[model samples]
Target: IAHGEIFLTTGGRSMDRRQIWSAMKRLCQKAGVAPSKVFPHNLRHLFATAYYRVYHDIVKLADMLGHSSIETTRIYLIESGAEHQRQLERLGLVS
Candidate 1:
């Protein structure tokens, strides 16, 4: 039923990065998105960044992201460019 279950049924086969990229491209095309603008890893990055922004709990983010080190999870915070915009807005620098 799940993808992991289907993988097991198919002799535990694993797809290489090229195959994964191809599949992602097809899906992105179907969704009317430019492949260049839709990175597969960005979804994970967005999830981690949003979770940390809402909760501000690094330990919980590390667990959710399956990161062995909290330092690894910190990398996702770098993608939060909107946080800077929010700070500037709060300071009345921008309406």
Candidate 2:
């Protein structure tokens, strides 16, 4: 891997955006997963959500994501309705 390169081709050259997306799509297909739901940008959302769950620090996450405003990071942390319902269920207040 070269400096600042997240992924590289077999020839040791840096992988461009299209190549990364294509690679991800092919891997998803091989794994029997829906390629439509998996992509490089979606992985950023997944990572931000999981990291926020563990740390609960939006400011740091914003910095890590290179966002000048924490509000932008908040968009990445939005929980799905299913997850929100699960949390409400765990509260035992609606039983």
**Best model number under TM-score:** 2
Q: Write the per-residue lDDT of candidate 1 for residues 1-95, one digit (tens) a residue.
A: 52342212245666655666677788999999998976657767888878888999999999977899999998888745697788778899666
Best by lDDT: 2
lDDT of each: 0.76, 0.92
Off by over 4 Å in 2: 1-3
RMSD of each candidate relative to the true structure: 4.3, 2.0
lDDT tens readout by residue for model 2, 1-95: 33377788999889988999999999999999998898899988988999999999999999989899999999998888999999999999998
Residue 34, model 1: lDDT of: 93
Taking all chains together, each candidate's TM-score versus the true structure is: 0.60, 0.87
